[model samples]
Target: MKRRNSIWMIILVVLMTISLIGCGTTQSNLENKEAPKPTDKVTIGFSISTLNNPFFVTLKEGAEKAATEAGAELLVVDARDNTAKQISDIEDLIQKKVSVILINPTDSAAVVSAVESANKANIPVITVDRASNGGTVVSHIASDNVKGGSMAADYILKTLGNKGNLVELQGIAGTSAARDRGQGFHNVVDGKDGVKVVASQPADFDRAKGLKVMENILQGNKDIKAVFAHNDEMALGALSAIQAAGKSDIMVVGFDATDDAVKAVKEGKMAATVAQKPDLIGKTSLETALKVANGEKVDSSIPVELELVTK
Candidate 1:
């Protein structure tokens, strides 16, 4: 009976040890199941205003190159200058769980909702070139458009001897670029007694539109001496119209020193262009996005350098 009792005691000890070991194994498995999943890679979503423009194309290329160098994935979506499409694109990027988002807003006021959506998702947003009027943007990387406009105005004033009739070719009506550039130009040209802005019209930042608008303005304002377009696309269009009308004497100044605009300037067709360094903006935007993803602090507003390209 004693032997049987001792054997039962040994069995109980073995069973308890096995039970404890099993419990430990179960706890280990539970912890493993509860562990957070790791991401395979960082993905950046770039919502461009329009890839149709050469400037934005260059910007995309710059961003792509940087993404490749940094081992990050870049997904580009073109809004085609449509605000609705841009908003939709941001929503899709959010659904895809992109690590970061870079937006080149088509319209400042209209893009607010989309930017706010990203904010709600707790995703960082960086604006390039154009700004959004409302949103929780982590950083904004763009040229000082107002200063650039002033630069163009100063050059135009000097060229025209501070006395001439000017035509202002505006960008998309609601864009910050258009508003700020116009403000800067007017800051200098508004009260000037010598020069007058005879016609200020919107070309919607399109080459063809610029041509048509300028053509219409030229019909009534043949005395125009200079043209200041909000962008190279409009400036080039205006130049085309001016050439067609045999108004070779009118000097044209444009922004966004695009390839065609730079060439025109070198050829003495365009008086000057503001160089926004779009590629650098793109590159810097990607870099900033990465920093934000890493939980690094960045400035709320980042300004890219600007230069005036002239003949």
Candidate 2:
């Protein structure tokens, strides 16, 4: 009877042990089902000319948001409009093994070596609103600046009745937008007999420089009929300078269609401004970047349309 009792006790303990083990596994399974979400570990790098301009600030925000949405880390570095600094920034990001790189080149042609290095490292590059000397990047996204520029010139020339002495304020010397817009305007103005380009100078796309430069031009030239500023900030500066100089006869054209540009157009402070949809550029760029990083086919080129605003 004692032996029978011992056997029964052994069976009971074994059954209890099995029951506890099964319960522990079931609990573990439930806990695992409620485990924390897995996050993707991907990093992207962005190097812009500078955040000194509001347009670039918006662009950064778009890129950051897009990266976060796709569960990636975005590393942004501002080169303060310096070519060497920009190249170094890109190299630093590359060393960190950033999966992708987006650069807004300070000097369009100077970033080529950095791009080639990225290619050798098997990393892809996306250029935003600028192009290198060689087509070394996977994609280039920007507005149709040449067309926008042409529109500005056309509007100015047509409104002035095809006869005006115009002075153009250019942007940063080597940037693609600066070159394209200035040349695009020249394309229209230089061909016309009635339109005379008086004096053109680089203002480095600064509002204060535009004001000072315009003031000098206004003082030096009495027959100034119009001004084409490469950017709205410069245009606004020129408008202020004109008001100060008591030069009310000159019509002013500007680019970038920034909020101030649009407001100036509404106020008739500027004759016309070419508007580039900067926000849309950011949005499309981020979308394309995600596609590129995910091994999906993306558009090699995305062109943002430009509009001319006049009041």
lDDT of every model, 2 decimals = 0.93, 0.85
Q: For each candidate, what TM-score against the reference?
A: 0.88, 0.87
Those runs of model 1 whose alpha carbons end farther than 4 Å from true positions after fitting are 1-40
Clash totals, every prediction: 0, 0
**Which number leads on lDDT?**
1
Show the colliding residue pairs in model 2: none
Worst 10 residues of 1 by lDDT: 33-42
In the range 276-307, model 1's lDDT, one tens digit per residue, is: 99889899999998999888999998998999
TM-score of decoy 2: 0.87
Cα displacement (angstroms), candidate 2, residue 147, comes to 0.9
lDDT of 2 at 141: 91
